[model samples]
Target: MAFESFSEFLAMGTHGPYVWSVYGITGVFLVGMVLQTLSAKKKQLKRLHSILVKDVSEREK
Candidate 1:
């Protein structure tokens, strides 16, 4: 193996923190984007449902 031990692997010869930090930041942003998309979709569906219900009620009157 290129690394003698687990610590050595993590250190990645002094570049570990930079490389790992980038990976961490990327993961956080990706997760945030997914959550935001799901939230927006739910909000839109609720709004659409309310509009449809109002239209239907008006027609029945």
Candidate 2:
């Protein structure tokens, strides 16, 4: 309602670049953080599994 058209809405009355850039940066960081968390979790699980396997094998001896 504030903007007359789609292009005008995107322009955001001369603040488009700054506003859109901030949004883009935030989205990138959010995605990066999610991916990093998943990767770290996978690595941690693998490490724990290895430690448990080693412990069990030692117990068998």
On TM-score, the candidate that comes out on top is 2
Ten contiguous residues with the weakest lDDT in model 2: 1-10
Report lDDT (CA) for all predictions.
0.98, 0.99
Tens-digit per-residue lDDT, 21-53, candidate 2: 999999999999999999999999999999999
| Residue-level error in angstroms, candidate 1, position 59 | 4.4
Q: What is the lDDT of candidate 1?
A: 0.98
Clashing pairs in 1: none
Which portions of model 2 show Cα errors greater than 4 Å? 51-61
| Backbone clashes, each candidate | 0, 0
Name the Cα RMSD for model 2: 2.1
Candidate 1 residue spans exceeding 4 A from truth: 1-4, 57-61
lDDT of 1 by residue, 1-61 (tens): 9999999999999999998999999999999999999999999999999999999999999
The per-residue C-alpha lDDT of model 2 at residue 53 equals 100
